[model samples]
Target: MTDTFKHHLELLIACVIYGTVGIYMQQLEDMSIGSIIFYRIFFGLTALLFYLSITRNLGQLALKRKKKYLLLLGILYVLQMFSYYSAIR
Candidate 1:
């Protein structure tokens, strides 16, 4: 496939996944929102690490500079996810 075609396909798949998140969240209403968020992040992180390892890019995560900025970004991401899930609940 052409690069543009491949990119569009990926975006479409992502949109479908995004649209289904609320449905899945509703099905998991018995679980605490925090637990649901934790599982989502954990599974996402696991998939990312698996992909990076498979592509031999795991070492790219090691940064000698801007470590503080990375930490800040991570904190912001968790907060954003927490708020998003809370709102969904």
Candidate 2:
């Protein structure tokens, strides 16, 4: 396959995995909902940071220049997540 076709295939696989995440999340019976969400976010963030570090893209993020905007986005994201999980439970 060409590079473009390979990238599209990877993206399609990612979407399928992402779409199935909720089904897997519903299988955790022992843990509280909060614990489940915490682990999900923690591991997701860790994976994202690791990817950025491996690709040397951390510097490209330019957090210093975008600190204020990123902070605002972070707050909104937290609020949205809180509402989502709360509603689901």
The Cα local distance difference test for each model comes to 0.89, 0.77
Give one digit per residue, the lDDT tens place, for model 2 in 13-77: 99898667567657765677668667878998899999999998997766557788888998887
How does candidate 2 score on lDDT?
Answer: 0.77
| Per-residue C-alpha lDDT of model 1 across residues 1-89, encoded as one tens digit per residue | 99999999999999998878888988998998778878988999999999999999999888989989999998998898788878877
Model 2 residue 24 CA deviation (Å) reads: 1.2
Worst 10 residues of 1 by lDDT: 80-89
- The C-alpha stretches of model 2 lying farther than 4 A from their native spots are 52-62, 82-89
Q: Which run of 10 residues does model 2 get worst, by summed lDDT? A: 80-89
Task: Provide the lDDT at 41 for model 1.
Answer: 85
